[model samples]
Target: MPLSDKHPTVKRRRSQLLNHFLAFFVFAVIVVPVNFFTTPDHVWFFWPLVGWMGPLALHTAYAMGLFDRRD
Candidate 1:
């Protein structure tokens, strides 16, 4: 299902999972040896990590009361 289509709790959990994936993706970008093995260096390996930072940052902001939804 589309992420927005999930139930509230499922959406929250999915958000958390996406956050973790982003965290792992960032780590993998630096840990993987693809840069050393590839003839032409590629930066695309960091895409997932970079993409994840947006959600992670927002989550952090929400957790820190920066969002202030007032609900």
Candidate 2:
């Protein structure tokens, strides 16, 4: 076996990570403009984007093997 992971679940996590990134990109694209035009002062769009980023970051770390340990 290789030093890296070779599990089906890891593969799924990587795929999900990509999909999540794409979805978040689309969400930001849509919300930013709407928020800007409707209420430019508050910039409420920033909150949701930041909130969504936390999960994405954790997902990315897992896919990158940041939490993996071999014994």
Candidate 3:
């Protein structure tokens, strides 16, 4: 369905998903290359990926209504 025709909650979830995806993309693009060239020996990209993934997972759950209290 088109975004304009979806319910408000659906629209909000879509927006959140898009925002999280873009943020992850930008972060990986910048951080991975910098960590690769600047510290080729250590290769610490996993640290950032771990940190970001935790919150991203939580965000996905919340956006999917895992935490919603529908009574």
TM-score of each: 0.42, 0.73, 0.84
Q: What does the lDDT come to for candidate 3?
A: 0.84
Of models 1 and 2, which has the larger TM-score? 2
The prediction achieving the highest TM-score against the true structure is 3
Kindly give the stretch of ten consecutive residues in candidate 1 with the minimal lDDT sum: 1-10
**Candidates ranked, most accurate by TM-score first:** 3, 2, 1
* Cα lDDT, all candidates: 0.62, 0.86, 0.84
Q: Write the per-residue lDDT of candidate 2 for residues 1-71, one digit (tens) a residue.
A: 22335677777877888998999999999999999999988879989999999999998988877787766
Those runs of model 1 whose alpha carbons end farther than 4 Å from true positions after fitting are 1-41
By TM-score, how accurate is candidate 3?
0.84
Which regions of candidate 3 are displaced past 4 Å?
1-5
Model 2 lDDT on a 0 to 1 scale: 0.86
Choose the strongest candidate by lDDT. 2
Clashing pairs in 2: none
Error of 1 at 9 (Å): 15
lDDT of 3 by residue, 17-68 (tens): 8899899989999999999899999989989888999899998887777877
| Ten residues in sequence with the least summed lDDT for candidate 2 | 1-10
